[model samples]
Structure formats: C-alpha cells, structure tokens
Target: MLRSTGKHSFTKSTVIFSLVCLLGIALTVDVFWATRSSSSSSVYSSIASNWPREESHVVVLPKAANDTDSEETVDDKANRVPQRLLSATFADIPAPELEWEQMPSAPVPRLDGSAVQIKDLLYVFSGYGTLDYVHSHVDIYNFTDNTWSGRLEAPKDMANSHLGVATDGRYVYVVAGQSGPQCRTPPTSNTFVLDTETEKWERFAPLPAPRYAPATQIWKGRLHVMGGSKENRHTPGTDHWSIAVKDGKAIEKEWRNETPVPRGGPHRACVAVGDELYVIGGQEGDFMPKPGSPNYKCSRRNEVVYGDVYMLDSEMKWTVLAPMPKPNSHIECSWFLWNNSIIIMGGTTEKHPVNKRMILVGEVFRFQLDTKQWSVIGRLPYRVKTTLAAFWDGWMYFTSGQRDRGPDNPQPKKVVREMWRTKLKL
Candidate 1:
C-alpha cells in the first residue's frame, strides 16, 4: 500500500512540475506580445500623425511582422528611403517658410571673395578685405560645427579678385582674376588648384589670356571659361575656352578655344545645369573709352547694365532666352539654379561717378526657363554687391559682399560682412 502511495505521489509531483513550466512559458510569451503591441502601436501612431512644425526629419519605422501582403513586397521597402518620409502620406507637413536667415559671420570680413561647397563644408577664397585690401586667405565654414574653425592660405602666386572659380568636389580651380593694391589695375592668367583635402594650392597652366570677373563652370569634365574684363578695359570678349582634365587633373596648360558665345560681356554669371550652360546679366559696353577708342562715342562713365540671357548647348551652340525685366550691373553676384529656374539675388546697378558710389540693389529676380518669364521673388534686407552665392541641400547662401547705401550717405560704406541665406522651397 505504501509503495502504491509513493508511485501516486511521484505522478502528482510530475504533473505539478509540468503545469508550472507551462504557466511560466505562457507568462513569458504574454509579456513579450504585450510589449510589442504597445510599442508598435505607438510608433504607427506617431508616423501616421502630421509631422511636427519644428521637425525637419522623421524616423522611418520597420515593417510590421504581419505585413506579408504580396502588393507591398520587400523590394518596395528597399527602394523607398526619401519617399518614405517625404511622400504624400506626410503631406500635412507644411512647406518651409521662405525667408532670409542670417548665418554666423565669417571669421574674416571679405568682398569679391568666391565661395564653393564640397559635401558639408563651405570655402571662401581670396577677395577684397577692409579698406579695399586684397586677401589670399581661405576661410572655411563647417556646417557640422556651425562655425569657422580653420583658415588656409592660397598659393603665393594666386591673384584673386572677381576670379573665375570652379570645383570638381575635390580640387578648387581658381582662374584668372585681377589682383593689385588698386582695384582692377592688373589681371592674371595664373590658375591655382586647391586640394580641399590637403588645403594646399598648386599652380596649373595659366589661362590663354588674363580675364577679370570672368564666368567659370566645369562642364563635361572640362573647365568652360567665358566672358569677363580683359586687359585694361571693361571690354568683354566672346572667347569661350575649355581645359581638358584626366584623372582629376588638368591634362594640359593650353586652353582649347571652343566656339565663342553669341555675345560678350564683363562679369557675366554662368552656371552648368546638366549639359547646358546658362549665362546671365553682365556689363556689355565699355564704361570708359579712350579718346581714339572705337566705343568712345557711346561709352559713358558707367558700363551699360544688361538683362540679357543666353544658353549654351552641348553642341557649342548658344540660344538667347528671355531678358531680365530689369538690368542689373551687379555682374559679380552669384545666381542659383532651382526647379528649372534661375534666381538672381542682390547686385549693384550702374555706378554714380559723380557721387563715386554704386546703386546697390537688394531685389531678387527669378527666371523660369520653361515659361521664359520673369518674376520678382523677394528682396534682401540691404543692398549688397560683389557677393558670392552658393546652393547646398536646398539652402541658398550669400557671402559677404560690398554694400553701398548710396544717396543716403555721400560717402557710403563699401563692404558688408553679413552672410544671408534662404530656403529654396519657395
């Protein structure tokens, strides 16, 4: 009878142990499902809701475990990165308000300085400093740091002033520009390439001829240099030259003069969009002519500001586009290409020789290439000229340029160190 009792006890103990193990497993699974349900529901709710006003980014959620629908396959998930956040599902997010936001001032005040961006960094090259002082220092602004952390010196032979500048993401090519104690006295053909990674400048073959305020663009792996102030005058020539490159370096010091542009003007702004080069606003006619010069009869003290527009195709052909509504003499200002349109910001008009001051205009004009139309987008807070403009990640940045309050002050201030920027969403 005792033996029978022991067997029964053993069976009972075994049954209890099994029940406890099953109960623990069930509890563990219940906790896991509960946590997952709560977390996934929260994530979906946040993603489904409208994006916050101040939020500029969104975290994409992983696919749900049960999302095995044939229509929404794995390939769809792999292909959609930007669309996942910026698609119509997030349409409630308001477009960025278009306005100029002042960024941190550059370490050194400069005007007529050329600017270029590689990745997240912005580099400002040589320009006119205080009291019309010429500079060869390169000031770099780090977007990550939100500050100018370092400065690099240009090559000793670099003559920078309204010089043609271009970058192929690694090397910055500084082309012919004027450099002298006095403004616009001498132009140099010296070409200097700055390796951004090394912060060092190396000399390249000089331009065929010296050019000041010329427009430069890297098109089809070659440097296309166009109109600018030549020699001792503001005469713009139709010379268009291309410098070939191989393995990220200039192949030769010689420039192959391509088909000349349809027209010539000093200080024209040129930008490359795909295979086409768009040229805009320049000072065409000579402002000052000698007594025996051909243009002496029509030449005035100030060059004629133009609102003309032209496009150069891949075939080396030029096409004239709709002219600007108003002529601008700020020939050195930078222009932005966005949404198949061109945006021209602050630049100066003709100079007042009697007053010895130029009329600085803060007007912003946009050109729609498709419609061949013009519209006034907005205006800068103050009139500035000789400023350089660069676009990166949908933001337009204007670096320090000279600003003359003209008429308000007989002796107007010459330069402004303020850097202004605005969103391109508008």
Candidate 2:
C-alpha cells in the first residue's frame, strides 16, 4: 500500500502553552514595575486630586481657546498629513495572465518516475505501476513533434522506483533505488549512464552505500547524491557523496565522501543554484516513546514532517538556512530553478484519522537566496503527488502523477496521463 511520509503523531500543545505562560509572567512583571515607580506612574489622575496640592510640583499648560470652546471634529481627530504619491507608467500595464496548457500524454501511465529534459525532449524512466508492477520501460517525449516515442529499456539491474536520475545536457545518469515492488524493499547500489546521442546504456561506478529516494543533481562537472532510505523506509541514512565526471564519463578519481548530515530522511527534494546545492524538506523518524513504554501517553512513533533546509557550497561547507514556512514531506515534489530563485511545486502529506487517506495540496513556494526567506508564490492547477516538473525556455511543464483526493478506496484509480504547462511569471 502507498503511504505518506508526512504524518506526525506527537502534539506540540504543551510547548505552546509553556511559551504563553512565560509571556504572561513577563507582562505581569512589567505592569508591577511601571505602577510602583514614580517616573513611570499613570498620568490619568483625578482632577480633584491634582487641584491645589501644595506638596506636588505639577504645572498644567493652558489649552488654546479654540480647542476648549468646541470639541474637535471626527475627521480632524483622525486625519494625518498627506504624503506625496509616487507615479509610474508601469502601473497602467496589466498583470500577466498565468494558465495551464495541456500537452501530449506519455506512452504509458506511470507514477513516481524520473523525468529529465535535454534540449527539446523529456526522458521518463522506470516507475511504479498502477497494479503493483515495477517498471524498466523508458519513454521519451519530443516537444518539437508533440509526440511520444519509446527508448531502450533501462538496464535490468538499474530498473526501480526511488532512483536518482540526472543529466549533464548530453548524458543521463541513474543511481541507487529500491529494486522491488513492495513499498519497503532492499535498496540497490546499481548505477548506469545512458548516452543520449547513441541510445546506449553503460555501467558506471556504484554508490559508496545503498540509497533509495535520494536527491540527485549535476552541479559543475560532478554528480552530488545525498540522503535516502537504507535498511528500511523508516531508517533514513545520512551519507552524502559526489562522483567527479569529465567528458561524459565518471572520472578515474575515487568518489569523494563528504561529512554526513545531522539528520537524514527519504524523498527530500534538492536543487543546485550555481555552486551551491540545497537539500529541502522531507520525512524523518519521530523519536517518541513507543506505545507500551513508560511515557507512552505522549508517544506516537509516526513519521515526522520536516521544513529543515540545508545548503552545501563548492568549498564543501554546509550551512542551514531559514526553513520553508510549513512542513513539506512525503510525495516526491519537483524543485525548479528559474531566474535565480528556487520554486517548489505540488507535493503530498497525510492527514489523520490515522489510517484513512493522504492530503494533497497544489501550493507553490519560492525561496529567495539573498534574504534567506521563503514566500508562498502560487499553486499548481490541481493536487498532485509524485509528479515531475521541468523548465524549458520560459515555460514550466508538470507531468504524470496520481491525482488523489478525499479518501482512498480499495479499487484505486489509474495513474494520470495528463501533462500541464504554464508560462511562469518570473
């Protein structure tokens, strides 16, 4: 069964209540100090008490005759001096319209596949099938022809979901992923590279350790792979490594293993901007008490959603940035680079009644590198999970995934074959 990585069982109400209590105590102390001090005492004393008090050094300024003779009008009391308005001709121009355009569907309907764009074609790799079939089929879609075609099947050894696929504009690289049909399977280190020009596949050096659902990116001339499932789906591993590449081949140098992350999780979306790589939100194990444990009342070992974001630069330095505004986890969402800003669109999370269904949202978020802030930009046309997003020229394309809504039933629907494109407002 498909499960969401976004569910959390522990309550944060206790922590919130403690913070409120602290604020209340701070307010009470401020009030006591203000009333007790002479310099800060209340100024609203009765007129009778102030009148003719010989011991007090009080001087009242006389009010203007116009002010005392008539009460101020409501407009006069509320008005402020007007400031000069700045004018610009651009304000007359209408805002750009954003809409989705349907494109040619894939040859076969699949979910959780890896989509990579090279020039005018989009190559989709192996994915999980609607009826529990794991695929090795490779499909290619050409934008110029508005048609779909079949490519050679991915190598038998490298066929699976959770695979890390990336391209260097010439060659495509496939990395580790789960090798079975089950949600929780033994992750493999089988790796390969396909020559886009020759239409042939060749084996490449495997990962240092097994990983599934890892985030992969080709920055500069190297392939950087980080964070994923190891022994089991819940067991997130922290290992990160990069393989040096030159002239469409893995360099002879050994794969460099970097410092491990503080915490690791599966299906985290990562993207590369210039020399830096960003590891965005994903799922991690909640280290709470078990059901039968001593502190079991507060414990639910559910999967925890994360807004934890970390960045790694060229010098091999890692820095944690301001997190996403909300928890982002579970579904394999796409992270895109457009006009120097990062855009994350469409992913899923689980809502509770404990075993009912998944909650999917089409929300969009943008991360600004200069200010280290994230803002909600907009949303997708529909709710999607495990969808793929690509950018070409000025248009953004999103394709092929399950459109889950409300509750999941025994007989699930087929995977979507629709592809949607939009001209992004940069």
Candidate 3:
C-alpha cells in the first residue's frame, strides 16, 4: 500500500511539471508572435502612408506629340497647364511666392559659363561647349522678342571654364578660370571684362593666385573671389581676394586677405544679397602620412563632399547657416532675392553612377534673410550642373548646364541649349 502511494505521488509531480512547461512555451510563442506582427504592421503602414503622398507631389512633363498636327496643338498649349498648376501652388506659400515657365533655348549648347541680364536682354559668355574646347562666343537672348542671337566672340585668350562672373550694372566681369588642356595642371589667372553696352571683352588685372571653381560675389560695389583650388588640382585654398571696379576696370589695389574659412575646400557656388554673401557645397580632404616623416602623401584624403552653408556678414564675420539636406558637390547655386527672401536653386548632389542614383536637383529652397529659415519651392524641369542663373523682372532665368550621365562611366558631355524662366509671385 505504501509503494502504491509513492508511485501516485511521483505521477502527480510529473503531471504538474509538464503543465508548467507547456504554459511557459505557450507564453513565449504568444509574445514572439505579437512582436513580429506589430513590427510588420508598423512597417507596412508607414510605407503605404508615405509612398502615395510623395508620388502625388511629382510633376510629370506633358507627353510630346509626334505628328505635325499634334505638335502644333501641343505647342499651343504645351506649357500653359504646367504654368497654371505651379501658379496655384505658389498662392499658398508666403513671401517670395513663385511660378516656373519653360523658355526657348539659346542659339547653341553651352555649360559652365557666366550669364548676366542687362535691360531686357540676357548674355551668356565663355563656357565649355559640347566639345572639350572652352567657348569664346557670346550668345544673347532677348526676352521681349523671345529670340536668340550670337554676338561677338570673347577677347582672345579670354576663353575659359569654371570662371567667376559678376555684373555691376554695366559690364560682366569674368575672373580666374581654367583655359588650357583638359584635366591638366593649373588653370589660367587671366581675368576678362565683358562690356554689355559695347558687346566687347577686355582684359583686367590678374588675380594674385590662379584658381578655378572659386566663389565670387558683388558686395558693396566690389567683387570678391574666395576659396578656390590653387596649384595642386585637388588641393583647395582658403584665401580670399577682392577687387573694386571703377570706371569699368578692376582697380590695381592689392587683394586684401580676409579671415580664412575654418574648413577650407573648393567653393563651387556663391550668391550675394544685400551685404551678405552665402557660399555653399564643396569637398574637404584628409591627408595620409608619408613614410619616415610627418609629411603626408598627396592622395585624395577624406574625399568627402559637404552641404555645409556659410554666410559672410556685412562686417565680414562668417556665420554657419542650416546645412543642405544631403551631400552635394560641383554645384551651381545662387540666391534670387525676391520680396525679402532669397531663393536658392539648380545644384548637383554627390557624384553617383547613372542619372538615377546621382540626382541633379531642380528643387528651389527659399531662405528668409531675416528669419534664417528655409522653405521649399517648385522643382526645375530637369537635371543640370555648372549652369548660369539670373533674376530679372520677377523671373529667374536658368541656362547653360551639362547633363550628368552616370558614375560607372561619367561623361562631361550633354550640353543643354534650353532656357527656363520661372516667374516669382512676390
């Protein structure tokens, strides 16, 4: 009878242990299933909610008609609808309200040049053409007639690329750019002045340092050139120089050195509004140490591009502005002072393979000079780099840029002859 009791007790203990183990296993499975379901549901919800909204915002170009009759019809109403849509969107945005309208192309394909609007006419000068050669011809486009005409050639030895251009009401100054052989050594120090009134080009005082890709702006009636690569193609400098223009010539006074940029690199784009100058987007290096000494081998160090924005105040103080959304290099950024806000536009992001991965942004951002806040504007018609932009009569004209291919085989080909005039609602 005692042995029977002991066996029953052992069976009872075994049953209780099995029940506990089963309960724990069930709880574990329930927790895991709950977690996985919650995670997947959240992901799907986010993706579904986000995707359509983005798609809706995209502006699709109207389809081109192939037949002559269709072409004529489309041309009559081609950009009319797009302009209306853009105008409606701008009504909601506050100061510097804007609209975009496509314009006819210049006479020839050009990029990496300088453009200035004098009176009702826009002049583009000295840029890289479809071929590798630097262009000397000046092209004039009249907004009144909606026609384009080629003008006199730039002065001999004045043909250049990557030059800094600024207009002081009468003439456009082309300063310090690359002229000789492709992808070769140092660029030229030659500076050329284009007289908009005369349709003639003349030489100016040479820069102390021969540089390319320098940031330039007209401040207080003086032209300033800052932060460009010198000697070593990859090594950019922090030097700053200024030339005061008087009677249509750059004064012979020595370049006054200003405060060096904390982080020095190439200055790809710049804009001057009022008394402030904003410089944006370039690369910084990190040198590797050479063997045996503290000296370093000149390889492309950090090789990192930036979206950093720097503003030089009227008092010549440098202040950091809000950074760009992403890293970009070799941009052609400028500020269009509309109402009280400045509109920034037309720049390239970091280099990537193909046109897809590597994006050329047409998105315009408005920077309120007083508030220091950035707001998004309408996008551009297409991708462009090293383009020239000018603001006139409440419209922004963007012209002459190279269309990027891809990274696997990047080509500096694809020159654009198209011109786009985006009217602002300010």
Candidate 4:
C-alpha cells in the first residue's frame, strides 16, 4: 500500500511540472508575435517623422517708397553721384540671408595662426601671441559642446605664424610659416602632421623652400602649398609644392612649379573649393628708393598692393576673377564654398592703418564663381584683424586676433579670448 502511494505522488508531480513548461511557451509565443506585428509600423512612423517637410513657401516682394517725399533728399542726390553710384554697387545688404551666434573664446589670444577642422572640432595651432611673451601653442574648440580646450603644442621647436594647414580627413598637414628666432623669418620647410584620433604630432618631410604666409589646400589626395614668402620678408614666390600620403605618412613629392602668380605679392590667401583653388589679395614687394633719386632720404614708396582674385584649375591653369573692391593687406580672411558662392570676410584694407587703427570690418561679401560677380552679404558685429577664420556646420567662426587702436596709441595690442560665429543661409 505505501509503494502504491509513492508512485501516485510522483506521477502527479510530473504532470504539474509539464503543465508549467507548456504555459511558459505559450506566453513567449504571444510576446514574440505582438512585437513582430508592431515592429514594421513603428519603424515607418519614426522615418516619416524625421523626414524633411516643407512648410509654407512665401514669395518676397519689394515694397515701394512712400510718396510723402515729392523730391529726393540730399542723400538721394549723393547716391546719384557717379562715384557714389559705383560704390552703391557694393552697398551693404541690410539683412544677411545668414544667421550668426557667439561661441566660446579660445583659451588664449592668437593671430596669424593656422585653423583646420577635423570632424566637428576646429584645431587652432601655432599663432603669433604674447602669451609667455610670444608663443607657439595649440588650442582646439568643439562645435558640439561649444567649448575650448588646449591640445599638444606644435612638435619639437616648431614655432610658426601665418603657416598653411591642410588635412586629408584623417591627418592634418602643417606646412611652412614664419618660425624660429626672428618672427619674420621664413618657416622651415619642415612639415608637421597631427593625427586627430591619437592627438599625436609627427614631423614629416621639410618644405622645398622656407615659406611664410603660404596658402595650403588638399586636392586629389595631395596637399598643395602655394604663394608664400621665400626667406626674404618682402619677397613672395609663386612656386607650388605637393605632398602625397601613404599608410599614414607624408611623402614629399617633386615641387611641381606652376604658372607664377600674375600679381605676385606677399600675404595672399588661397583656399580650395571643389577642383579649383582661389588666390586672393596680398601686399606686393616693398619699394626701395632708387640710388641718387630725390626723396630717397625722406620718402619711401609703398609697394603696390593687390585686390585682384585668381582661380587655379586642376590643369595648373589660372584665370583672373573680379577684384576686391578695396585693396587690403595683413588681413585675416577666410574662404568658404557656400550655396554656390565663395564668401570672404575680415582682412585689413590698405586704407586702414594696421598699427594705429584697428579696422574691424563686419562687411561680408560673396563671389558667385559662375557669374564672376561679387555682392555684399552682411557685416560682422566686431572689429578684428589678423584673426583666424574657419567654417564648420554651416557657420563661419572667427577666433583670436589683434585689435587696432587709434593713431595716438601705436603699441601692438592683443584681441585674444574671444570668438564669434556667423551662420550661412541659402
């Protein structure tokens, strides 16, 4: 009788365990089916919400002037003047189709430095400064965080000003600039490569010639250096050189000399957009008095400055474009390919004195590459010179430059620890 009772209990326990397992399986099936049924619809809703949807498109029409003024005012007569009319062609557009915002300032003041964007961060390096009384420091600003941070200093005794910086998506190539004991000395052809991922600096092949104020741009997987000073402070060279990379190292190629710049001058700025490189205005060679000439003792003729613009194609051919309305030198300007136009801003005009007067130009201009025409966009809010400018995320950024004082005070000044951004609109 006891053995019979034990067998009966064991059979009942087995039946209960089997029932529990079956219930779990049924619940899992119900959950899986429910999830599978909703997955496609959920995905579709997410994509639809994110898709760009056009709102009302309104057409803008110009408004006519009020008829209250029967006769034109004196200002109207002034506008009618031939010279004034020509100047009116460059009139300031009251509103920029673009928007602007202020960003965090650099850790320190800088001018004549190099700025290159890697991903979302703008890395600023080796500018002339008064920190520790003239320094070579590297600082970086992140667009995502809108903050500034210091990075590795330029590699091994690398002090530079107005150097050319270019990048190939992974590594930043620092070309020649003014370095060494004298601030005006041409930079050693020494090339420095900064790896963005590792935050490391490596020295590469030296440039063919000691160059300063040279413009650097990357094209067809090679870095191009063009139009800079060669040793002499006053002399500018049109020689162009390129460097090819292999397996994360820079291999200096033969210096491929191109057509010398037609209007050869110093401090000319260049930028690469699409397949073309545009070279802008700079100061010409200094004018030395001729021997036995009158006014040799008292008068020194200034070198002719250029406001002319030129474009270099992939074939090494150059074509001149519309000239800048005002000739400028020692100006910190930036170039960007925006909405089918090449926009330029900042830089000091020849009419403004760099030492005594700080002409902070807020005026923005755009060059329609297709039409060879220039039009004013808007003015910058602040006055700055010798600052570094760069573009990222549809905004133009200006960082660290010199401020001009009135003629009474001629001492060199600093405009560090400030940053500004202007957004481009279509």
Candidate 5:
C-alpha cells in the first residue's frame, strides 16, 4: 500500500514507527545468526575432541590361549580411540612408529625376577611370588613354540629374588641377591650358572659381598656386577666386581674388585654395549622391616627415585651418560639393547617435585649410546615395575611386575601376569 502512495501517504510518526520496526527485525536476525554460528564453531573447532562428548573405548579383553584373535593385536578393524595417537602438542613432528600387543600371560606372577633369553627359549629365574613368598623354580618359555616348558628347579643356594643375572647366549649367571624375602632378609653373594644347552647347573666363585638387584652384565669374557643395596636393605653398595668366565665356568677362582659406580643402588637397568657397561635408573632409599616383628612390617624411609646414568668404559673408568627423562626406579631388568640403543620401559617416578610421591611410569625410554641422548619413544598399556624384559627377534617383550595401584597410593597393589610385546624396527 505504501508503494502506490509512497510520495504523499507518509506521515512523520508512521514513517518513524516503520523505520523502528525495520531496525528491530534486523537486530533480532543478526543476534540469532551470531549465536547459531558460535554454537556451531564450538562443536567443530580446530580439533574435533575440543567439545564434550561420550568417549567410546576399544576394550581389549584378556586374550585366552588358542584364541585366533591374536592377529587383532595390530589389525583390529574395530579399534577406536577417542583422539589421534599423536598429540597436537607434537606439532608437525612425526612420532616413532610403535604398536603394542598383549601376549599370553606369563606362567607365573612375580617381580624382582631374573629373565634371560637364549636362542629360542626364555628362562625366568626365581623371584618373589606372593607377598615375599619366593619361587625357586625356573619357568622357561619357548618363543618358537609359544609354550612353557616344565619348571626347572634352580640351584638350592640361589637367591629367591633380586638376583643379578646375565646371559652369555647359552648360560645364565646368577649373581648376589636377597635369599628369601625383603626387609629382614640378608643378601647372598652366592653365584650359580645354568647351562641352557646342557640343562646343567654349576657353582661359580661368589662375589666379595652380597647385593640386592646388583647391576650385572656379561662382556668380553667377564661378568661384571656393580651397585645394589647392602645387607641392611637400606644401605647403598657402590663396589664393582668382575671375574673371568668361560663356558658356564669361572676361569678365575675369585671376583676381582673393579671400579665402583658413581651412584650405587638397586633396581637399575644394566646393559653391555661393545665395551661400555651402562647402568641406569634405581633408587636412593629403601624400606626397612621392623627389627623383630613377625609380620615384617616395613617402614618407608627417605626413598628417592633417581635418573642418574653411569657408563663403565673399556678403560675400566666410570663416566656419566644422559640421565633419564624422569626419575625412574624398579626397572632393573626391564631393559634391553636394541639397534645400538638401550630401551628401558616402566618404573616408579616422583609424582610431585616437592612431596616426592612415587608414581608408576608407563613410558618406553631409549638411550642411544652412539649419540649419548635420551628419548621417550613409546608408552605401555599400563604402568609397571620390575618387568622382566628381553628383545627377541624384532619385538620387545616385557612381562610380570606389580601393576600401578594409583598416584595417590604408590604402594604395590596387583602383580600382573599379563605379557605384552611391541615390534621395533631393527
């Protein structure tokens, strides 16, 4: 109607009212679109995970023996994760290729156990079974057959847990360790060797003194043992000892005193590369059991987890290497030499910088001897300590340790028998 009378029908009040109505409609539409655009952007931001949504997990049920789903370890089409494997924090850096698969559970559950890999067989020595109850049997797993051989009885004098063990391909040499359990028990200097080829046991010259979880490795016709807790379980031992060995027999009658470690403690990862013997991780303090208490109530003292790394060179001199990314302990045997790099996985770390609360670690750390550098390469499904680790073929296998209770409660909770392996490019 205003279009036909546009020139003369316009009153001043009506024109003002029309203009006001038009402004109100425009503001309402603009506000509606602004709110709708904000809502849309929030849901679909730079990262799809920015908004809140129900998380769907790809649950991996414990695989049973004879389950054909083993191939699902890597090829599972149903695998779904809440976010990308690599974090946005990584920027454009390409992460190392890594994939982990849960293998069949170990024959038994134990920590502080000594594991040695032979040609095709894995020999697991005695260790603390349930609450300080030690198992003196050796459980052998044949990687070729994926079967566990019958339990082989260890030497009667062999320490039950915290044994310093090394393999010369066919022979596993057991060094000093705690005899029975923790706390009240004293360490044993008794040494024994098991010949995997002959299925025989032989006694060797003992260490000068006993140690708990001593850093042990075989290199250049010698077995070197260094650094561990003393008999009191709270004292740190820095002494190093070595003896000439040949074909499962001690060529020398006694262990010769060698160089001492810069920092001495137990639960450290020791690996021999060429002429260098590297010792990494371990602790500074230990729990002490009551003097005469029957229950063996241990007191957690000034426990300190450390990342110090020491290398014993061919010159028989001690040198320092790159420390761990974080303070980690209780990874004594959870390490192996892979492609000139020492790969260490899982341990306990100081959760708080001030309070020093211990928390279990689940990361795979690599120390390249050639570059003298440390890098975090991967992560495990869960955090664990004292995992018996060995590199077989191209896979890194680790099994049997105390699963993390939680950060709040750093105490040992569940000792798991689950075995896990990850493929590594050689």
Candidate 6:
C-alpha cells in the first residue's frame, strides 16, 4: 500500500503542476524505474497515487489573504479541490468472444479458479461462481474428446475461490484460501489432495500460514507454498512452507517453514525450474473493508502491483532475476513453462496510462530461463485476468476468468465459460 508521510505546503498552482507531472509520468516511468531496479532484486509500485477513491475527499490547501489575517483563518477559508476525475473507456464488442471451433462450454462461469492437467484431462477446481456465490465442485475436461466429461464434489470445507493448487502429475493438492463471500474474511488453513486415478479426496496437513492465494508448486519431490495475503486480507505475507509427499500422502506430518520471499502478496506466479523456485508478478495491496460499512464493503486503496522476480536456490538462498517488461498481477495461475521459458498470459498492469486504475494486460510475456531475459512474445485475443492456462502438445489453451468487453475495459465482467486455444509458434 502507498505509505505516504510528511505534510507539505502547496500553492494552488503548485498542486496543479504536481497533478500534471503525475499525468505525464507514463512516458518516463519505465526508464526511471529501470535505473533504480536491477535484474536479481528489483522492486516497484504503481507510482501513481491519485487514483480512484471510493468516496470524495476534501483537500484543504493553505490560502493567501490579507497580511493581517492569522494563518489559522486562511486555512479555514481554503477552497476544496475536486480530485482528478476518472475518465475510463471500454471496447465496443464483448471480448474473448468465441468463434467456430465448437469448443465445449463449462457448466458454470468461474472466477479465480485453479486447474491441473493430468494426461488427457484437465481438472478444474473450486472458484467463485460469480462475484457473490462460491462453487464447491470440480469440473473435468477431456482433451481427447474436447468435452467437459465429468464433475466431482470438493471437500465439505474448502474455500470457494483464491486457492493454491499444485500437482505431481497425478495427486493434486489444494491449499489455503478465503472460504466464503464478501471482504474482511479470514482464509482457511485446510489442505486437501485429490487422487485422480481413484477419484478419491483425502485431507492433508493444514497450511502453516493461511493465505488468500499463495503460490504453490512441487519442486524436487516436495510441496512449497509461499507469499499471499495474511489474515488481514489486505496485508501481504512472505512466509514460506513446505512438506515432503510420496504418492498422495504427506511424508512429513507437519510443514517446515523456510526462507521467506523478498516481497509477499497474492496473484503471483510460482514456477520451478531445475534447482530453483521462482516467484513472479504479484501485488502488495488489496481492496480493503471501508472504515464503518455495514456489509464490510471494500474500497480500492493505494497498492503496488509489481513485476519483480526472485528465485530460491536448492540451498534456500534468494537470487534476483530479470523483472517483466512491465509490472503485472492477477496472473497467479496463468503462467506455464514452454521451450525453456516461462510464458505468462493475460493479467493487469501496474496502472493505467490515462488514469489511476490498473489496466488489464493483453500482451503475453516470456521469461527466458537460459538468457535470464524478458520479452513480450505476443498478446491475448482479449485482455483477461486470473485465467486458467495450460500448454499441451503444440497448443496453448486457456479458459475462465474476467475478460474485457470493450477495447480497454478497466473492470471487465466476472468470468467466462469459453475455452480457446492457439498453436504455439514453437
């Protein structure tokens, strides 16, 4: 979150000048940040602070008046300044609009869902049914037939969305996440495993640090979950933990806490390559509960959506890696490895060039493991966030999540059931 400090006196003209500077930053922000950030340990935030606000605020600047007037009297008479207005536009047509492939539609629209591919089937787990309802069923899609073949019920006490899912190509693990609807809710520590071969679900050791959407991965025969929202939901947690597993059962009865991530937050990507574990593209702030609302309505506050990348070696030591071409978030489940590179699909950028709102990213990014470099490889058909992605044979397939309806919709409608695929260029 934007931790602002110190009071400063500003003239009306000075305030106007500051606003102009904020608006022009889009042109220089990349170069300015590049110098301050480096390849192995970069950090950044949405530099723009005058974004949207849930409620209007009164900015009382000191005013000049007759020399005889007291300083206190001038403060009382200062005029209020309306905040920078929100001037957002959208694309004319609906996005992720499907065409004639005749891909089968999912039974329901899901947001923030988790999925794992096993052989010819993709197992899609629980997510919010929409913005209000939570889903507890698992959907199975068969690639051999190109159809959603089956559905299974999840654990009785699993979070409906924001889960951390990892797989060993057979046993899929579902970790902590928020359990229900609304804001300001504590996340669940429940961890469960589903054995695909047997269609059986088993309970496992609970997560040591329950996170809203922690990055979970299986590296060198162990399960690691790291970096997500703490109990407060607004505060990011960097705590990391892991446990040994054999078949589908935990070899270790309890989790072992390891070195923490450099920065912590949800909506980040966790991928394992060789002896290293990498964390990429997450945000530090969240939509928080209002001061005194009856339903605990959430309001967007100051935040840091960053592309800083870090890697953990076999010795648990941290190493910085090249950051993304631009800051990205809401890509926790949308990253996968292909051709010795980590490919990230649609998500959101740090902030909009024209406004304070974070904008959906349409470009596809590739982080090359061999060269340790980042490049914009391609762009999505429609900008999206929290999309479930998988790479199979020569095709890149993705489904679910919110998609832009217009050219650049800031806030897209929640979730789509359509699935689309494109053959990778290789």
lDDT digits (tens) for residues 167-199 of candidate 3: 777888787876642443456778877777777
Off by over 4 Å in 6: 1-102, 291-296
- Enumerate clash totals for all models, in the order shown: 0, 0, 5, 8, 0, 4
Cα distance off (Å), candidate 3, residue 159: 4.1
lDDT accuracy of residue 305 in candidate 3: 66
TM-score of 4: 0.67
Model 4 alpha-carbon drift over 4 Å, by segment: 1-100, 180-182, 246-248, 251-253, 286-303, 331-333, 352-360, 406-413
Task: Look at candidate 3 and tell me the lDDT of residue 255.
Answer: 69
Instruction: Give a tens-digit lDDT track for model 4, residues 135-237.
Output: 5767888877788865777776565676777777778878777663234343577778888888888877777787767767777666778776666555767
For 1-426, candidate 1 gives per-residue lDDT tens digits of 999999999999999999999999999999998897688678766865765532433434444455455686664455433322321121112222357889888776777778777877888887878633778888887766567777998777788567788878888888888665344444788888888887766778788988877788888889888888777657777888998875447887688988887777676677788888888877765444445643233234556667678888888888898876555655454676678887777665545433334456566777887786887777665666667676777777787887655634322266667777787666
Q: Model 6 has how many clashing residue pairs?
A: 4
Q: Is candidate 1 or candidate 6 better by TM-score?
A: 6
TM-score of each: 0.69, 0.69, 0.67, 0.67, 0.74, 0.75
**RMSDs, each prediction?**
24.3, 22.9, 13.8, 29.4, 13.0, 17.5
Instruction: Give the Cα lDDT of each candidate.
Output: 0.71, 0.68, 0.65, 0.64, 0.78, 0.78
| Model 5 residue 40 CA deviation in Å | 46
Worst 10 residues of 1 by lDDT: 86-95
lDDT of 2 by residue, 1-426 (tens): 123322221235666788999999999999887666533233323433464532312233333333332565764344322221221110111122358889887766777777778888888888877535768878887777667865778777885788888888879888888765645345788888998998899988888888877878888788888787774555778888888886568885667887676568776777777778788888775223234544222233467667788988888888999987556664454766776688777665433322324445466778887787987776666666678777777778777776654333311244777887888775
lDDT of 2 at 299: 34
Model 5: colliding residue pairs: none
